[model samples]
Target: MSKVDFDEYVKEYDELLNKNLSFFSKDDSYFCRYKADLIKQYSSKNPKRILEFGAGIGRNIPFIKNAYPESEIYAYDVSQKSLDYLEQKHPYAKVIREFKGFENFFDLVFCSVVYHHIPVDERQKATNDIFSSLISGGEFFVFEHNPLNPVTRKLVERCPYDEDAVLLSPGEMKNTAKAAGFNDFSVKYYLYFPPALKISFLEKFLRTLPLGGQYMLKAIKR
Candidate 1:
């Protein structure tokens, strides 16, 4: 699949995303805050520096800031336009287009639904780069759509930016991180029910099920 240039979609990014995912939540921040909440609940480390990998358009910026207001936050993406939008919207986040002199720099690296957009062959190299950037014992939090879930598959099929998406399984995520030298890997499925069918209490019990619309993978650089 040919890579989609995100720069072209920076203008209509939010609209297009909402068109597809609005069913889950009318407010876009609902999805963004979910990741931040997961981080806060699962993480044991008080990172001095946090990195938002593939932070396109920075929807998560405010929530991340809310979660760690004092920690220095850095945003990185291949799309300059997306980075520009992120910078303009959230001045607190320092944006960078390239990874240079950043090894062992970040205490936590976060990625959300970004891996599917990456070309399959390049994923290993990208994972390796993330591994190299994190400080020893730093955590990497990655969230991705689970292709096993029919709803997620349909959403990806309908979204324009996801035209080239190749969804990865939970096993693939664990193995890829392992190959990149990540240890203590853990993964939990999410979005088990849509807005209407969702039962808050039962949701936690369903996290181990692999049929959720999405999954979160946590790994550490040990």
Candidate 2:
């Protein structure tokens, strides 16, 4: 297969994402809220700076902003168009095309559902970039589709923009983090029930199950 042109792919996805932003709204689903909660729990107290890697259209902006209210938030993505939309929607965030001058600049970095779209060979470089973006002992929260979940598989198959997506298992994510030179990290499985079937009382119990639609890898930079 030919190498996927991520720059072009991102631009196309930016347009699609803008129109579908409501689907990712935090208030619309427990999944979004739960992911945000995880981010809030793992990040440092009063983080000085935060970066949201692959923050397409800034869907996680509200959650990150609320989580680190006192911190300077930066948004990074491959698409300028997506960053443009994110900037207009979130004027306070500093949008960047690359992590060029940001080595060791952030206390926390949140990456959500963006890695599966990355080509396998390029993931190492992406992981290393994220590792470099954070200061020593900083936190990196990575969320991705759980390949073990049937629903997740179906959703990825049905989504038009996800044509190139290759879901990563929790083990794959953990290995990527470890290969990036991070020895301190833990993987957590979450979101067992979809919004329509979600029962609030059972969420805590269900979170222990590894059959959720997605999983998160929380790594600390050394």
Candidate 3:
């Protein structure tokens, strides 16, 4: 797949979101709830500093802010337009294009649905940058589309911005983290059923199954 100019896509990003509001809302709500639970469960101590990698338009800011009210949140993206919107919408977050001066600074870094947009050849370098930005034992959370899921694949096919996306499987995400020198890692498959069909009990068991619409990989910097 060819690399995409994300800056160009940021112009129509909100339009696309409006068009697919229903579809996007379901995934967003599900992930936000899931992330809240995951953070409470995984975090050993209160995170004082947090980074959102590829934080386009700051979609994850609200959830992260509410989850960790005391944390200083920062957003990073390649699109100035997106960063502008994010800064306007979320004044609490500091936006940046480069990771300079942030080595071993963040206690946690969260990335969602961004890796697929990155070209395959550059993924390792991107992961390394993320790894370097984290403090030792700090956690990195990555959420990505599950290519094996038919629903996920179909949704990506219909989304215009996803044209340049090259979906990565769970194994690929683990390899990316490992290549970046992260040793303690874990992966969870989630969102087995859409919002309408969501069953709490069933979802619990389904997490073990890799057929969910999306998967999350957590790696701790060692």
Candidate 4:
């Protein structure tokens, strides 16, 4: 979308995400629990630094900061309004420009539901930038929407969502990571239902299966 729409969306995204967070938090859906676990798994408890790209509104800051209270947390986003909100919420985080030369600088770098906002063509360049920012052997974690989900595909296209959003398949994500100078890349599916759905048992069962509606891809810097 245009800059105006991006700004407007940022102004309103909290309401939308807050609703989902509330719904998902009621029963600790596997996705919710799984996301936290994934972050912990990638983040070293005694990390000296952390970087989060596309960290709109600092949604993951609280948990990340809690997990590594002594580490410095740096974030970057293109939206000024979103960064404003992030600064308000997480004064401790240092906001940078786009993801450039982030490689080998952080012990763990992550993004949540954010990579989709990257254009399909430029996604690789973005991944390269993310890779450049990481420290050797540092892990990268991404919580992304699954493109194979018919329901999600319909809604994302139907809405006046960010124009840059491009859902990618599991294999596509792995390839992008591999092309970005990463090794040991892998994608793990999770979140088996629509955000509005309210069935934890069903979510858990769905996640246990081979296919799910979302995923968390973990990779290491080579």
Candidate 1 clashing pairs?
none
| Regions of model 4 farther than 4 Å from truth | 1-5, 18-34, 42-45, 101-103, 193-210
Q: Once superposed on the true structure, which residue ranges of model 2 sit more than 4 Å away at CA?
A: 1-30, 196-198
| Tens digit of per-residue lDDT, candidate 4, span 60-104 | 777777767888998888777788888888899998856554547
RMSD of 4: 3.5
Give the per-residue lDDT of model 2 (tens digit) for 1-222.
Answer: 353344554446645544443343324434556777887765555689888888887778877787678889899988677787889989999998866866888888888988987889899999998888888988889999889988778767776677788888888888998999876777777766544554644756665578877788888887
Could you tell me the TM-score of candidate 4?
Answer: 0.81
Candidate 1 global lDDT:
0.90
Query: How do the residues 1-222 of candidate 3 rate in per-residue lDDT, one tens digit apiece?
Result: 666666776667766755654654545455566766666566675888898888998877888888889999999988778888889999999898776777898999988889999889989998999999899989988889999998889888888888899999989999989989997777777777556654644766676688887888888997
Residue 151 C-alpha lDDT in model 2? 71
Give TM-scores for every candidate, taking all chains together and pairing residue i with residue i.
0.97, 0.86, 0.90, 0.81
- Candidate 2 CA-lDDT value: 0.77
The weakest ten consecutive residues by lDDT in model 1 span 192-201
- Candidate 3, poorest ten consecutive residues by summed lDDT: 21-30
Clashes in candidate 2: how many?
0
How far off is residue 215 in model 3, in Å? 0.3
How far is 14's C-alpha from truth in model 3 (Å)? 3.9
Name the lDDT value of residue 193 in candidate 1: 55
Give the per-residue Cα lDDT of candidate 2 at 35. Answer: 78
Give me the overall lDDT of model 4. Answer: 0.71
Q: Which sequence of candidate numbers ranks them by TM-score, best first? A: 1, 3, 2, 4
